[model samples]
Target: MRTSRARFWAAVALAAATVPSGLACIWDGDTLAAEVRHRGYLVLDALTGRFDRLPPEYYRKRYELASERIAKDPSALAAYDNAAVACERLGRTDEAIDWMLKKQAAMEALPVHDRAARDDARYRFHANIGTFYAHRWVAGGAKRDDPDALAALDHLTKCMAINPEAHFGREVVQLGMIEWLNSERKQSLGDHLAERVMSSVPYAMDSSNNVLAEGLAGLVLLGAAWESVDVYNCMAHTLNFSFDSSLSFVAALRVEELLQSGKRPLDQSEGWRITLDDAASFWEDQYKKRYRTELTKVYSQLRAAGDEYVRKRNEYVLARLAEGRHPDSDGGFWSDWTEPARVELPDRRALTRSQFALVQTLLAGGILAGVVILILVASRVSRSRKRAR
Candidate 1:
C-alpha cells in the first residue's frame, strides 16, 4: 500500500510539470499567430492607408489578446513589442512606453550564453525608443525643455555606446539633424553632439580604407547634404583631392543642384512624403548632368588624393608581406595611422543686432506708410462727395 502511494504521488508530480509545459507551447503558438495577424493588418494599412477601414474595436481586441498572452508568459517579448506598436498607433503613448519597457526587461533576462544576440536586440530597442521620443518631440512643436527630447537624447546615447560601429552612417546623420533642430534651445548640448558626430568620420573612413573605397565616399555625401564643412574638409585633407573625386564627386554634383535650384535635395518639412523612387530619380538626374569644366580642377586634386591613398596602402601591404604576415589579415594595413586633426570651421555670416533691427523697422515703416496713404485717399474721396452734394 505504501509503494502504491509513492507511485501515485510521483505520477501526479510528473503530470503537473507536463501540463504547464504543454499549455505554454499552446500559448506561444497562439501568440505567434496573433503577431502574424497584426503584421498583416499593418501591411494592409500601409498599402491602402485604410487604418480606419477596420472597426475601431478591432485594434482593441488585438491588443487585449496580446496583453492577456503576455500576462501569462512574461517572456513574450515579441508580443510585447507588437503591443507597444499598436498602443502607439492608437495614440496611447504612455501605454506604448510601458510595453516597450516590459519588452526590454524581458530581453535583459536572457541567459548569459545569449549575450551577443541580447546586445543586438538591446541596441535596436534603444534606437527605436529614441526615434519614438524624437517623433513625439517634433509633434509637440519641438520645445527645448521637452521631456521627449531629453528621453530621445538619452536613449540614442545609450544606443551609440552599445554599438557605435553598427550603423555609423545613419546614426551620425540623425545626430546631426537632432543637434540642428535643438541648437537654439541648448547650444552647448547641440555643439557637443555635432562634435561627437564629426569624431566618427575618421573611424568610418578607416573602415572603408580598402580597395573599394566604399565607406568614406557615402559618409562624405551624407555629411555634405547635412551641410557639414567638417566632413568635406576631412575628405579633402585626408585624400589630397579637390572636390570632384571619389564620393565627393557625388557631393559636388549635389552642390551644383543646390546652386542652380536654390533648394535642398532632401526637404525636412516634407518628412516621409518624399518617396524612395523620387529620391532615386533626383540622384539619377544629377548623375546625368553635363560634367562642369569648372569641376575639372577639383577632379585633379581628387585624383592626387586617390593616388596617394593607393601609394600608402601598397607600401603598408608590402611591409606586412615582408614581415611574413598576410597584408589584409585583421586589418593590419593602415591600422597604425593617425586620424586627421579637426580643422577650424569658418565663421557663419549672420546679421548684427543693429542690422536686424533696421530690417524690422523698415518693414514696419513700409506697412504704416501704406496705411497712411489709404487713409488720405479715403478722406479726399469723402470731401469730393460732400462738395458734389
Candidate 2:
C-alpha cells in the first residue's frame, strides 16, 4: 500500500513538471505566431510611412518579446535577425552585436555541406558582422588599438575568402575605406592593414559584372586620399571595361584633382587620363549604336552640364591661383570642386525615355507571345484528350 502510494506521488510529480513545460511551449508557439503577425504589420507600417504613427515603445516591446522568444528557441533565426536590427535602430549596439554573433554561431554550426550550399547566406552573415564591427569601431572614434576594428577586418576577410564573386562588393570597398582612415592614425599598422584591405578591391571589381559604380568611385577616392597609386590604377583598369560615361567622367575629374594636388605623378596621371577618356569614348559609341536618335541629345546635355561645372570649378581655382595660393591649401578647393562632383546629377535618370519605351514594348510583346503560345498548347492538349476519349 505504501509502495503504491509512492508510485502515485512520483507520477504526479512527473506530470506536474512535464505539464508546465508542455504548456509553456504551447504558449511560446502562440507568442511567436503573434510576434510574426505584429512584425508583418510593422513592416507594412514602415513601408507605408505609418511607422511614425506608432507609439514610441512599440519597437522596444516587439524587440523584447522577440529576444525572449529567441532565448527560448534559438532555431528562430529570423527572430534573431529582427531583434538585432531593432537593437541597432534603438542604439543598443552591444546587444545588436550579441544577437548577430548568436546568429553567426547558429549559421556556422550547420554542417559543412549545408553551409556550402548556402554560400550567399554565409557570406552575407559574415559581411554583416564585419560591417557592424566596422561601424562600432568608427562610433568609438576609431581607436588605434580597438579590438572591434581588428575583428571587423577579420570577418570581412573571411567574407571575401568565402566567395569573392558574391554581391558584397560594397562591403569590400567599405572595409578598404575604414582601413585607410585608420591607417592615418596608426601609420605602420594602418598602412599594412590598408594594403590588406585594398587587396580585396580587385577581387570585388572582377568578381561581378554588376559591381556598383558608386562603390568603385568611393574606393578610387579613398585610394587618392591615401596616395596609393596602385589602388587607383587598379580601379582605372576596371573602369576601362565598365563603359559607363558618367562614371568615367567623374573618375577623370578625380584623377585630375590628384594630379593637380601633385599626389599622383605625371606618368600615372597620363595613363589614367587616357583610360578614362577611352572609356568615355567607348560608351559614347555604344550609346550611339543603341539609340542613334537620342544619343546626340543626351550626350550633348551631359557634356554641357559637365562643361558648366568644370568652368565654375576652374574659375574658383583660378581665383585661388591669382591670390598666389594653392587651390587646396585651405581645403576650400574640396568645397569648390570635389563636393560639387559628389552631388548626384539632378537630371540623371537611370534610363532615357527612348530606352524606357523600348523596354515597355519588348515586355508587352513578350507577354502577348507567351499568352498566344499558352492558348495553342491548351487547344492541342484538348484535342489530344478528345481523341483519347
Off by over 4 Å in 2: 1-72, 105-113, 117-122, 185-243, 247-389
Writing each residue's lDDT as its tens digit, candidate 1 over 1-389 gives: 23322433333233222222110000111223333433322211111111112222434545776788789998766567556655655667677777778878888776766777677667767765675676678667887758888887787778767776443244554555555567553322222333444354432212112111222223332112223333332222222111113233333333343345554422222121212222122123454233333344444444344345445545555565556543112355446754222212111112333443344345446656777999999999999999999
The residue pairs found clashing in candidate 2 are none
Q: Compose the digit string of candidate 2's lDDT tens values, residues 1-389.
A: 23322433333233222212110100111223333432322211111111112222433655766778678977665566567655655667688789778887876666565655567555656766676777678788888758998988888778778865333244555666567656543322212322443344332212122233333333322111234433343344334333333433333444444556777531222222334344345444555344323433444454455455546655665665556544212445335444233222222223443453344345446666777999999999999999999
**Each prediction's TM-score against the native?**
0.38, 0.40
Itemize residue pairs with steric clashes in candidate 1: 241-301, 241-302, 242-301, 242-302
Ten residues in sequence with the least summed lDDT for candidate 2? 21-30
User: Local distance difference test, per candidate?
Assistant: 0.43, 0.46
**Cα error of candidate 1 at position 30, Å:** 21
Clashes of each: 4, 0
